[model samples]
Target: MNTPAPGPGTLAEQILRGVGGAENVESLTHCATRLRFQLHDGEKVDQAALDALDGVMGTVPQSGDRFQIVIGGAVANVHSKIMNLPSMSGGGTSRPQSDADVKAAVRARGRGRFAWLDNFFEYLSDSFRPLMGVLLGASLIIAIASVLDALGVVDFRAEDKSATWVFVDAMWRSVLYFLPIMVAYNAAKKLKIDPWVGAAVMAAVMTPNFTGMLAKDSGIPGITCTTNATLGTQECVARVFGLPMQLNDYGGQVFVPLLMVAVLALVYKGLQRVFPENVQLVFVPFFSMLIMIPVTAFLIGPLGIWAGNGLGEGMSWLNGNAPIVFAIVIPLLYPFLVPLGLHWPLNALMLQNISTLGYDFIQGPMGAWNFACFGATAGVLLLSIRHREKEMRQTATGALAAGLFGGISEPSLYGIHLRFKRIYPRMLVGCLVGGVIVGVLGGVNTEAFAFTSLLTIPVFSPTGVYVIAITAAFVTSMALVYFSDYRTPEERAQANAERDAAEAAEAAGAVGAAEAAARGEAAVTGDRETVAADDRELVAVGAAGAVAPAAAAAGADAAPTAGSAGEGFALAAPVAGRVIGLGEVEDPVFSSRALGEGVGIEPADGHVVAPADGELVTVADTGHAFGIRTADGIEVLIHVGIDTVQMRGEGFDVRVEAGRKVSAGDLLVEVDLDAVRAAGHPTVTLMTVLNTADVASVEPHAGQDVAAGAPVVTVRR
Candidate 1:
């Protein structure tokens, strides 16, 4: 019986074992082909074992205990499997000690050497990353409302709008107006405090009681208000308990919550230390609220408002005095900034600009970067379809949809552009072109904070110029990526070879199965003897001038008799290499004989020739493997280069098509060993017998180098 293929969960389990179990893994994330792991101790990992796993394409170890396991098209499944592992439950909550150790190690590694910088960015990322889904949802809502406004269905910005339009506006406003609470919750969670308490503190300031102070009939005698000359909006001060407190709208104010939560965590933690364990829950939260709420309203909130306004004013000055530079810099800077989470501060500035200036300019130029990103993904999608690259096609399709419709760039950025380095420079050029166009046309501005998507075109002033600029950016990037390609020439060639080999293998398998059915039918009809005779004759003809006389005689005489006691066959070496026992192969599938008994070969030459006269049964698209079936019922597999499927078929030349008859020693493929090695894969070629269970015994010869036509394995009854 054949060993069943490994299940996805089984593969994940094997990978976890290979990577020193869950304890060694600090955290894991995947992008396309590789599982990126930040490990607690990279030295503890068994690299060789990881590389040998059947589903894993290869292993790469980076600096600082970072490891990557390449899984090809099935990366998403593997990633999901790993995340769902029992040890990975609740986002590392189940294994607190292990998680704590990993985090400490990471901090210790960076301690005292700008480590705070890393922690600061991590804090920012964790705070905003969780809110991305809702943010996109709100942006798309704005896009829809803008679309209706553009068509004159209703005025989206009017204060006295239709009730229906007003309800639609509230749908998106629900997220933005409460954004501070959301940010507070996330920030507090990151700092290991009660998230609800942090949200409660931010919410207290936004309550109706605070806003009631703005009304002229307010009962509080100490309340005073003044109108601002710059914005023409009323600013109010409320005297509470003999102290003056500035009352400002807290909606959509990210800085206040982010700053407030940091202070809250310190107070909360200090209170926890003071209270006994039994009363900690009630007393700690109570003390935290008593301390933080007052501090936030009296100090941090006003300071945060000032900081945001100052930054917004500085950016506005740059935009006015140097419009062209501002426009160009915004688009170009965004590509790098967004990936690092540094862009959140700038995002906060955009909201501030809309509130104070009655319009925002940053998003107009930022559209160029977003469109350029989507365009590059589109180019990859087109290439995937053209080349029959199923995995890439799926990835690019989903990424493009998320970008174009939702104004979300994360999917495309992490899934594609980052994987292939060539895409960035080309995408940047598109950003530049779009920015220049906007600047030359006196720039684009939007009255409302809208996502820069096709649906939100109405939000921008001078819609025509915005449309032209974005179109140019999209077209330019798409054309560049399509023509030049995101992948290097070697990568492209390898991918093409893999596709061809897969098609050939599929075609060959169909033919082989049909032939096998016919032979089985002949045996049922008592024509076994004639069939056996024909098999010998066919083998002799195909192997003529290829095998030694003794080998040919053996094939003719040892042909399986009708209702034979056992099945047996021999495999000739397909390539000139130093032969090693199957047990010595790195890959577990072949080493365990899961695919059948095989011999590993360290190639001395690139040429791969047929080992026996037979019909080609399978051809791998990556130009890395081949399968053949002889008339005597012997099945053979010839694989070139270990983990080479990850290379897609680069540096391999296939000389013959699958399903074709070939004599022993026929040229099958030529591989470039140096190229394989350069691409970070092994050059060990393998030849295995797929039907080992049907055979009585398979004896493989080792301990010496073998020529292409050499009989390295013998199967017998």
Candidate 2:
């Protein structure tokens, strides 16, 4: 009694069921390759069923009732489907939380020794993540303007530029000039504080009244300006209430707002605690603004400015003295840093360099890393096309496009590079090659901060060097990944077999639907309704007709047996055992028949054999299960033991592979029952008809001792 198919429902319905229905899903979210669920009760999830799902690649159960279902490139589609289900209508994608829920969430977030480190990275990522669009937009504007400058159509750096070109400059400059305020707002929101308060405090310093004091001839009292000889930049100080306060331009200064918001959140939340709830909002923002504005202008602002400039100068010194070492280190470090969110500080330094030094040098070498990442994705795309892996091809195509055009690497990083271990080392070699070229040819610099993409190539100085470095990096990574192949040979074979089985199942479904339409029926055979036949025809004249000839040709040796009304088949015991009903099985999913009608066997020994002759459609990597599809379209699932997958093939010797034709009683695997028991897993062998609903009836002959290959289950189509 397999879990009865939810007829006519989409894959989302199946996923919802596998996650223990909508009621169990407290909140839902998705990333590149996985559907993240914060469940109300983790124990209710059907992990085995999810692993067996067609679209799902794997299931990861985390602490605090959190679950992640890996769906590869199709995650977004599957997530949309799940959210659109009628059962999910009561709430939005993320449900409202109660006091208990909040507490539980907090407890769940205690992710061991590095919890603070996790929170820190998450904070950094969220703060900058929202600004990516505007940043990319600004970078592209710079790219176009730089191209015109390079073509001699405009003197972009001239102080006497025409109004039209100056206006053009302002277009991209708007995003960078006010970046501090934007970062402040986002950082405040991430910390659960009043975002407007954070923005106001940072905006105060960038205001005309504040920046007007930077002028040496300003008539304002208690203000003085000086120019640094080394950096050739103006510095100002204002005497406010009989104290000297450093006055610095906060435009395009990300670190200032990042630091200011951290302090503001503390003050805002503290003010909230002091004031009554009704009057708290007004007073909290009031006090937060009052306290943080002065604090930022007098302390945090200068500190953040000095800190950013100090770091930028340090890197500049490294590039000046040892350009080769600096170039090599940056590209190599970025591949690891970006994934961990530790690269945000370096990104801030890049902006700081453009703002203070009027140019940035880091991005030139960094382009190597970006192109290398994209090149590896290209390799995957090529391999996917060769192997006919539709999912990988789709994923790699999108990731490569994002990388090359938008200069965004998260898609390539999370979607493909991280999943395959071999890609990183090969990509690193590309990074090294590109870095060396840039260093040996003299470092490239960009006046305007820009994303390292093909469109932004004009922004870098000495474009030839930059182009050559990136090309070398790209070609190296692409060749290495394509030649070596990402997946091991064994894994590749299994993946191809799974792909073939999925294709076959799709073809069978299409044929079934066409036949149903021909007979003027609205549904396919999957609806589980028996078809009415006219006279006792020797052969079934329907969708099954397509496979009847092959079944007949195989004759008595084949798995199926012709019945009076329809096609039928019998399944044998995979091991010498006493057959027991599914209800007696320890696993609830099987006991409830969610995976269809089946029987469990208490095996006397560990010699597992094939139950029928057909194509072995699926063989689990752990040797715990195998799916056989008969010539007459009977799908049988033979599972070795309860939770034996946890053993990871430690004591099981698998003798068969997927896509192979096997006869009844052919050796499938030899398991060590004692090893399974020692590992605290039950040794009951369960066999079920996965597609029982498609057949007429499936009967189990349980409660009897049976030898290997003895008939134990009967299926009728």
Candidate 3:
């Protein structure tokens, strides 16, 4: 018996089951549209079952036992649902790390050539990803202030700004000024340490008592202050416990926390082992703060400051000397960097530049890349509208909105750009154009760290240059992608055919419902069974009565039709061959009856025909598969060969389009069996009833020689 199709309420449960019943899941997290899972056993995942779920858009299997399920805009809700499931109460929220599990996971992660590199990026990403909402919020506040400053409503830079303005400034400044503590907390959590201990250690230096010593007139003994000639910034040193301490402001410094947490995790875990579980929690955090606070203040603080400054200086020199090259490189590299999570370090640099150098040059050029990405999505959206590709249109619409308004490119990149190969090249061209414009115009700079978005335009200096450059990039990519088209000709045709068939099926369903209502029957739309028949009666599988097509259309009460009784309808063989059970089809999804019960045929020849009279519901672009819905609503799928889609239609001649009416034994495609075999694909043709659960029974007569149009399966309503 088939499992019932999942609805919205059961989507999370189905997804959990699909990924090996929560036990296999190590950890689950979500970005904008996908639920990312780190699983213990990737092999245990049932990709077919998840794909069959209604809410799940698609599934992606990645390296190192990772899986991603795309849920589009509803990802957050679905993720919440999964986490809230009763089965997930134990260890589903995160991986349960026993000694053996940890060792095995480490081995799996270390197997790849660039395993360390992957781990490094993942660490950086997790530390900053949770901070995006706050960061974006702060940036927008800065943008509003910048706009007000531009409009001369109030002098934002005035030393004696009003109390209200200062308070407003504090709203955004609080997030940036205390950013180190936040990063430290997140980083510690990522490393599986006590997060509060990390936050406290970093917070120690940011306190008023420590910063007060920086004032030369504070009258603290053994304290000294100096001014840097090059950067024109004050430096302070103080004596604590008879040792010199570097009393620098740790506010907005991200690198310090990142460095501190790495060292802290080791100390934390070692302490955990040394002390028993009863006393460990209190002593661990107590000792971690005691050791890490001084280490951070005396050594890590100054080192991190120096490191941030040195990197900032390098970028400053590049922008000063080779402005054009620097500008061009920022935009072009961002396209690649953003996908790999390598962009986080550059983002840290942006904050560092704003903190140390008073303004950042990286964001000016990076805007070009962002707008170009949005432009490509716009092109795809326009084409989806033109081609009437409903699913693509919806995807592109949401992705484009997220990009243009939120200044987020993940939706555009992951949802559309990555899937289609043709889009990236065009988007790159736009990035190059925008970068060139910024380079030629003396480059752009922003005093505040802001997302490259239209709302934040005023935050950047030389706004005209930034505006012109981004516009050129957007228009260039949009025009190029729109003109060239995102999909190939064959793909477009196939997509349109699928759309038409879906529409026809929907229309047929509506007619069936109306006919049932007219006959005073309680029309149960969900209970109706549809076969590989077009314009035939849509029977209610377990309902009291079934309606015939002719009688239903005429609004008349009719007796059982030819296909309504238990005697059933015969589905003829599409080709002359020796029939076999679905189990022998050599395809797991088919052999397991996941797509429904059917037969496989070792073809004697290449000619393929319609199994029954119906409208062709779907015709694969690669000419490897067909779906037919009979007049009595039996949806049959005829797949020509195993994995033959990889052949790219090289040896198959298709004779029918979707939505075309056909009869039993009608030629659907001409397949070259030898060519299929040479391409390393099986030549055995397989057929299945797609809506098998909707019918009373589907019985396949296999293990026999069959001629074309010979009855090979019997179906009952």
> What lDDT is reached at residue 56 by model 3?
59
Which candidate, 2 or 3, would have the higher TM-score against the true structure?
3
For every candidate structure, what is the RMSD over all alpha carbons to the true structure, in angstroms? 15.2, 15.4, 15.2
Per-residue lDDT over 254-276 for candidate 1, one digit per residue giving the tens place of the 0 to 100 score: 77888899889989988888989
TM-score of each: 0.52, 0.52, 0.53
lDDT (Cα, tens digit) per residue for candidate 2, span 76-96:
998988888889885434566
Off by over 4 Å in 1: 1-108, 111-114, 211-220, 315-320, 325-437, 440-451, 455-717
Candidate 1 all-Cα RMSD: 15.2
Candidate 3 structure quality by residue, lDDT tens digits, 1-717:
133333355888888878887778888988555688989878787765565456655565555788777676798999999998988875564555799978988798976478986677567667776775676566556656766665678776677999999999899889878988988998999999989998999999999988889898999899999975434456788888999887777777767888899999999999999999999978999999899999999998888777554544556578778999999987887776665334544566676677788888899999999999989989999998887676678777766765666577766775677666678789999999999999998999999766676767888889999999999999999999999998777776565543433333333333333433432221232221222111112211101011111112121112223444476889999999999887676765556454566789999999999999999877765567887889988888888887665555668898898778999888999999999989898999988776665676677888889999999888888
Pairs that clash in candidate 2: 1-596, 1-597, 2-595, 2-596, 2-597, 3-594, 3-596
lDDT measured at residue 643 in model 1 versus the true structure, 0 to 100: 53
lDDT (0-100) at residue 20 of candidate 1?
73
